[model samples]
Target: MATPRIESHAFPRSWKDLIGHERIRSTLSSAIAKRRLGGSLLFVGPPGVGKTAAALLLAQTVLCRRQSAAEMNPCGQCPDCAQVRAATHPDLIQVSKPQDKSLIPLELLIGPVEARLQEGFCHDVHLRPMQGERKVAILHDADFLNEEGANCLLKTLEEPPANAVIILIGTSEQRQLPTIRSRCQTMRFTSPTGVEGRELLRQHIQRLTEAGQSPPSLADAELDEAIELAAGDLQVATRLASGQSNEIRGKLLTQLSASVPDPMIIARCINSHLDEISKKEAPLRRAGLRDLCSIAVQYYRGELREAARQGRYNGADARRLDRTLRVFREIDRSANLNALVDCYAADLSLAITGDRGSIG
Candidate 1:
């Protein structure tokens, strides 16, 4: 077959464009160099830690036209590398959530995504590349793949096609799949620091300026504010910049800044957030716990930061906030919340009268 034209929208082409996760990057590079790269790679990380980005970079490396037996990562300017970055390389497949929903429904596993999987898992890998060296299938949000979906993809996982690579990316506890998980080499990414995140915002700005386009999603202060709210999740910061965050950081900050001296209101705020998530959070699901704990931590950090900055909150209000934070942490750590929050509510009320001993 003739080499197809590279088709993806060109993105910032290398791992360099993605901030932090240096450890994960180094491991992947080493694997590629040793030609010991696994057919199945599990990128386990917090959201926005560049799991998806690194996967794409690896895809480009695997399919690079110039890669001989010698080099692993492709020279980005090469046709194969460019094509992968643009998301158009013929042999590369990008599988993500179903367009209509927030997740990949089970039907999709046996549908278009799997149809492609069927072709390449066995016979296709042995065939020469359509235009480049290998076929790539990137499974984003792999954790959302239900049991049936996971089983459906097992054939490929068990016996990946020759010269073929499958990349699985998922966040938090969803990152692991016991049977499938055992088969792959896992690369983990963590949230970067406020400092690192700000630096990335600067680079994004430079890129936007050079392109003569509207600058990237954040102004420096906006990025800092967002990173603080997100507890350093770049993906969250990006969403905030884009006005797409599920939670409005600015509005929340505003509310927190108001001089509400009432402990009831503080208790109520804590109840509302926990209540919204109570049913789904059993504290048993690792993914759910990870998300919940992270959120609570961020909330407390934001509250404290706001309180200190505004200086509008009295000690009673601050005490209630602190109590809520501690209780949330306890819940996150697997404490039974039905009783904990009730006691927390009482302490929050009594805390105003100078009593902190009984809640414990």
Candidate 2:
């Protein structure tokens, strides 16, 4: 039961406090200052990369009474800013997929069947601001919005209330419906990488230490591995730093590096580790499985690179890397966790053992 060194809920309150996305911050700040920001925007990026945080900051900047939107600054002391910080703002409406549900229900968008358009997000978004001049609606997990939900939202996006700002946060533009994508200004966000990533990790560790939440002394090598494996995701990097990543990585590499890897054993090992990480929560388990798949992708990629460097790269090595990558992609859309894990292990073992004919 390791305590999280960095809480995901601890989001940046201002542009300066956000870690990466310098270009995005600059563009947004300029737009806010010029009062030319769109009424509807889509924030697309990998998870844990500050899409939601930036949305909050934008809402605060627009709603802050002490400073005009032209200032592009939020006076944290203002009631608007304080309410946004505490998620109690009357004008700020937020929605996301429920933990038990796989999709953002249509009812959440347009009220229940008996109360359609009477008491839901769409209905609420149209109301006059109670404490501010404009309403700011943020819809998280936009990727989970089913077709019906997306259709119900089109009206709001097409003709929003005067001075209203609607922000949809998702991982990719392709995941959004075409009609939904066409009506909004899309801002793409990327994870911090290389030197920027390392610096951010250092800053995070320092913050944890200052707050007396730092884990046991971490070696530079451990930090470097975490950074490399995280591939620019700060949340994953922190999880890697929680002392579980090493054990998980060791198990993966040990099985993957064996002379004759066992698919069953690999599958069991991965599922067991996923269970430990997720505590049987299906969504958490899916996320944990994705993280482990990412680690495996890194492993295969390293092997491929090393082999190429030594002039030992071959068709078998290439296939192994390819299969690992495919498995990684499957984790996102697949629902059967146990079957996916089994197939992933079997496919990789087949690739590694040079049994290409038996694969697929």
Candidate 3:
């Protein structure tokens, strides 16, 4: 069966709707209450978390005409709130790296050669708010900002327009330039885990049902497996709950644990699964392959723990885990997916069967 896509409404619509990040919520709420929220903010966290959603919620709180900002409550029925939700608010400027490009183009920060400083994100941000007292700008994929692009944004970060809030969302603080990191109030977010993660998933499933959407029903075992595979990523868990990844995972574990796993068969199974999930799109296929590798890493680690518990762990077991780790990292730089898969399968087979040979 095909994986169900998460709907827009599934995303957080208010601070209360946002899952996890309790400390962040309290800090921002206190700042807003005291009218001391900074002009430039940096949100650093893993993907599938609520960084962007929190940014939007902040915008709504500051711009909502029906409610006072000090209350830290956005009246969702107001025009300002509606515009922000639809991403149609003139005062809210959002930018992200283009999928086809390796970096966020410098022109996006400033302007094209013919229109330098005349029009672009920097210019748009400096403009006075059209409907409210505040303007909010969010830059997604801030990790893709090249040196020139970062430089162009330096001045804006140093001195944002009055009542303007600029948010840069990325995976880690280390990925950002020193100047960018130093200029903004940084908020770190972590993925939900344990009871929090389980509650988050349950809430999502409940929301789908309440919204009258007929999502696939997950069995208790499947739900637990999805949670384990997702590792706190809600989006991945939703996909796994659809019953696709579970099948692939079962097959992968079975093959990896076999005494004489066939490299050709393993490669074919993985390739076929990738094709199904990615719809023949090369980028998505590569991403799926990396996710599968993450699963393998987990499996191998579990095996090592069990072996150690049984007093049978050895150097070969440690080497096998290391090989899997290397393969996971190399997937991003690999040019030929088929060749990489074939070689990885062969290497894994050799490691499992006590052979010293390896492709890498």
Candidate 4:
């Protein structure tokens, strides 16, 4: 498969180019200036924030031969900086969950157990840097690190190579093992502000123009609605700006407002719409699930407000709504859209009608 070519300037090459997390950049700069950078660090945040970008920028800066610690910037012209940007630097390593499987396999971290620790991420980090002053290994799917994998990494986290930095990136701290979390310095990232979200959307639009691709047909209130719906996640905002959200929202409003809710009917309706989204693999499939779930939540929130206005709010109704939300949360964790949709649809029916319901 061909790699997507990002317009040069659209790719985040420095801290300044990253979309959000202003304080994270400042704090990292201070650490570099004081030489207090931790050997092991964990970046915890929601998806589409600047965690990965910040990690890459910091890695490039750390490996830049021409930059002083006080400078805290990569000399972009250096061989080290160029290679890092192209992801070809020998000293920079990145590992993520493979598509075929759900978890980050243990071997990807420390090599096959039979290798006797002779090769792998852990073993490679122990060796001297092949090109730069230090090695930077980024574990991208830290949330999927199993017990054995986390244990395999513990030693390195405790006493890392003299000039190595190991950074774990994950969505939430709670998803990581306590033992692993305790040893690493943690950086928490938050969603961008409303203004920042709009700016990020515009930047993406500009990139489309530069790439000679027509931008999505959305403007003014519709664009703002997408930005607000995205809640500061740039990737989600991009999808929303493409007008997918409006289509999904329209379907959700009609079905959720039906006088006689039918879980099976609603489930089939959603399943059909999502099936038409594209045969384009996992990420799109996963995004469709997320968008549907978000619409359901948003729709119910409005219903809750109206019910309260009519003095019809009650504990049982609230509990049913909570159950519906929990199903969405589970969908995120498991990434199993099919398994949860029926249950979610049933819960939504119950929540709306205050009656027991099940998808037949």
TM-score top scorer: 4
List the global CA lDDT of all models. 0.59, 0.76, 0.75, 0.73
The TM-score values for the models, in the order shown, are 0.61, 0.83, 0.80, 0.85
Rank by lDDT (best first)? 2, 3, 4, 1
List model 1 lDDT by residue over 257-278, tens digit each. Answer: 4544244553454455545546
Where does candidate 3 clash, by residue pair?
A: none
Q: What is the C-alpha lDDT profile of model 2 across 1-360, one tens digit per residue?
A: 011122334667567878778899888878876777757899998776778888888888888999987777788788888888777788988888776667887878888899999877889889998987888988888898878899999999988887689999998898899999998999999877656665566665554454556545766677677777866566666667656556777888888787557899899888988888776577678767766766876777788788889988656657766776566445554457888788778877777532336332
Candidate 3 structure quality by residue, lDDT tens digits, 115-145: 9998778998999989888898888888878
Please give the RMSD to the true structure for each candidate, in Å.
9.9, 5.0, 5.3, 4.3
Best model per lDDT: 2
Per-model tally of clashing residue pairs: 3, 0, 0, 0
lDDT of 3 at 127: 92
Worst 10 residues of 1 by lDDT: 1-10
- Root mean square deviation (Cα) for candidate 1: 9.9
What is the overall TM-score of model 4 with all chains considered together?
Answer: 0.85
Please identify which of the two predictions, 1 or 4, would achieve the higher lDDT against the true structure: 4
Model 3 clashes, total count:
0
**Could you tell which candidate, 1 or 2, scores higher by lDDT?**
2
Give model 1's clash tally: 3
